[model samples]
Target: MYVLEGDKSAASRELLSRFTAPYYLLHGTDGKLGTGIRLLDCGDMMITMDVPTDFEKSLLRGKPAAVHP
Candidate 1:
């Protein structure tokens, strides 16, 4: 599971630290930076963003092929 947020990093970090699922993060130019700074108390998380317009293009790359989008 993952989230796309402009701000609220601290909150995200807090939640991510306790997240029970494998997760990813997509931090974007959503005009919320300060909140993001507080969310770094975590690992197994990184940011690689695809703006909503390009979502389908990113998902077509090769990965484990058993699942369908």
Candidate 2:
């Protein structure tokens, strides 16, 4: 799995389009509770959820690794 900041680039999209295996993209967004989790896509399969604020906190317990553009 790859954790990247910002939106997916055109090149990245193009590369994923050529893959036969499934791919999952998760994006963070602002919501009433706090940070919102968005399941961008899952190749042929599709799934989504609005992660609870508490759950988000648990998911990010450790110091985040800096993501360079």
Best by TM-score: 1
How close is every model to the real structure, measured as TM-score? 0.23, 0.22
What residue runs in model 1 are displaced by over 4 Å at the alpha carbon? Answer: 21-69
lDDT of every predicted structure (CA atoms): 0.35, 0.34
TM-score of 1: 0.23
Q: Residue by residue across 9-58, what tens digits does model 2's lDDT show?
A: 44334433443345555433233321222223434324333323243234
Worst 10 residues of 1 by lDDT: 48-57
lDDT of 1 by residue, 1-69 (tens): 234433334533343355343453333333333333334335333542212332333344542212111
Q: Compute the lDDT of residue 34 as modeled in candidate 1.
A: 35
TM-score of 2: 0.22
